[model samples]
Target: MAGILPKLIVFMAIFITLLTVIVDGESHSFSKTLPLRSKKLKREKMSHLHFYFHDIVSGRNPTAIKVAEAESTKTSPTEFGKMVIIDDPLTEKPEATSKLVGRAQGIYAMASQSELGLLMTLNYCFMEGKYNGSTLSILGRNTVMSEVREMPVVGGSGLVRFSRGYAHAKTQWFNHTTKDGVVEYNVYVIHY
Candidate 1:
């Protein structure tokens, strides 16, 4: 009888603890939901996409051209803009030159003195392929010496409306003499 009494008491104590926790949780939820029920719902549809961008920007060979602006030399830092074209690597040949894809135009404002990065605002226009007539733009700073730079995508137009996300760019090949390099981009796009 003594052992049974102790077991019954212990079981009652555990049951009481569980009941208290459940009651407290229900009361708290009721109190919190009253204010939330009056609030308006803001929901958005988000879609994710990934693609690769290969660019060969050059100043000498003229893949990327400098505008007729003031003191826009490559060696010394200057506020300048350039127009660049990117062709699809898969169809890159003399006869398949019409299979162009990207046209990136942007300006390079000297962002910092410490690392030599540019305050870049680039409009990447897709001229050919499945994403033709769409434009994805990005605004961020990229250091000249950085092997990889991740930048935020601002917005987009055409099929990619209301786009926002991030992109990673790596300088694959660079020429110090001609001020040109091949940049590989892995872009992540989130849009509605």
Candidate 2:
């Protein structure tokens, strides 16, 4: 009788909880708090990474290419409406021949008709030691002509899971003739 009483109490509690959830129209919620997958990073940690991004659009083997564009994009002063898909290499140094650390794979669109503003959506996938297989996602506005542009680090995967931060990009070199450039990136991220 005592064992049956305990089981009945538990069953009644569960039923009441379910009834309340349905009555409040919260039964559709498919969300619940769960423990972290890995407890190795119990405390939040900050990471600073420096790298050079090579955007090669004009080379025979281009890393970035215009995948789509509006009819008026070619005539537009800012090349507005043009969309570029990039698999640009992230190198240790400004030179393209330098050691490869990862690749910036994503797309950017000319979101501004008046200015050279781009809507960047990319993932910085690291291949170097310690950060191998980790990726940090960036989604923000980038005014390329600015001396230094800041963008948000929205989220990430692998070692960078639950990461959020910002990145500073400064154009190190740009060639008008080739439409190629090297942008230095200093990224700071916080993760747990």
Worst 10 residues of 2 by lDDT: 32-41
- lDDT for 106 in candidate 1 is 67
Provide the overall lDDT of each model, using Cα atoms, as 2-decimal numbers: 0.61, 0.94
Q: 1-192 in candidate 2: lDDT tens per residue?
A: 988999999999999998988777654568654577545558889999999999999958999999999999989999999999999999999988899999999999999988989999999999998999999999999999999999999999999899999999999999999989999999999998
Stretch of 10 with least lDDT, candidate 1: 87-96
Candidate number of the best TM-score: 2
Could you give candidate 1's per-residue lDDT for residues 15-125 as a string of tens digits? 998899788775664465444225432343454434333334453435444444434434444333333333323122222243445666665555564556767687777
Question: Candidate 2 versus the native: TM-score?
Answer: 0.84
TM-score for every candidate vs. truth?
A: 0.56, 0.84
Off by over 4 Å in 2: 1-30, 36-41
In candidate 1, the residue pairs with backbone N, CA or C atoms under 3 Å apart (3 or more residues apart, or in different chains) clash, namely none
